[model samples]
Target: MRKRERLELIKKLILEHKISTQQELLDILENAGQTLTQATISRDMNEIGIIKIPGPDGSYIYGLSKDKLRQEGHRIDETPSILAVSPLVDGLEKMIHVDVVPGTSRLIKRQLLTKYKEMIFSLIADDDSLLLVAKTDFYQQVIRQKLESMVVSDEQ
Candidate 1:
């Protein structure tokens, strides 16, 4: 699997289970038909900002970093905001196109997915742009407004 796919799977597993060890994560991935090494998993975890937080049972388990949880009112990292470069949001129907700073599209895509999961059907990020497919044209407009509002809030 690709690194992005593996990262998404790791996030899913971490969210669904109280995984506390690299070995356990490795085993789960293996069972899921993914052949990965401990080192690769370690790197993926760090890349995605996964950390060990207290689970319900008082033991530590893998979880997303609070800094990465934008939906929970946490401030995202100091990368440029979605409108920092004046992202061009254009759409014909259910698809919206956004121009982003080079190398920041993936981060923007992740935040958008987290904050607007129900509205987004699929999101693709390239080096300097994002293509977001919403459930409908109305949802696409909502996403566009939200992106603009992010810049407004950031400016205030």
Candidate 2:
């Protein structure tokens, strides 16, 4: 598999499982049919900004770095609803457009890129809008659904 695909899988595994050691992560990957060396996994984890955070039982578990997310303007304490006001999401062909609160387009863009990097070809953001070019029509629809789900209704 390609590096991007492998990285995506690693992220998913880390998020979905309590992976503590490099050996444990390697074993899980091998069980899933991914054959990679521990050195390569370590490099990939570093490249993707994954870090060991304190788990529930005081052990360290692999997790995405909150510092990196904060540096990207994504507040770890705030949800998407706080950054956007009923964002308008629309898509056509292989492109998806999202309209969010002014000054928050960049944050939303960063979130989208982080979550859907493999599906996205290019993403551009202005003061209150974003234009994402997906790798395929299917990816465009998937991205549209994800953006739409983040929309908060004024009624709620």
lDDT of each: 0.74, 0.75
Extract clashing residue pairs from model 1.
Answer: none
Candidate 2: tens digits of C-alpha lDDT, residues 1-156: 999999989988988999888999999999999989989998898777776655799866777765556766756844352233233345458876666654455556777789999999999988567888889988987888877777766766
TM-score of every candidate relative to the true structure: 0.46, 0.46
lDDT of 1 by residue, 102-121 (tens): 44566678789999999999
Q: What is the model-wide C-alpha lDDT for candidate 1? A: 0.74
The candidate that achieves the highest lDDT relative to the unseen native structure: 2
Query: Which residue window of length 10 is worst by lDDT in model 2?
Result: 79-88
TM-score of 1: 0.46
* Displacement of the residue 75 alpha carbon in candidate 1, Å: 11
Candidate 1: which stretches are off by over 4 Å? 71-156
Model 1's C-alpha root-mean-square deviation from the true structure amounts to 11.1
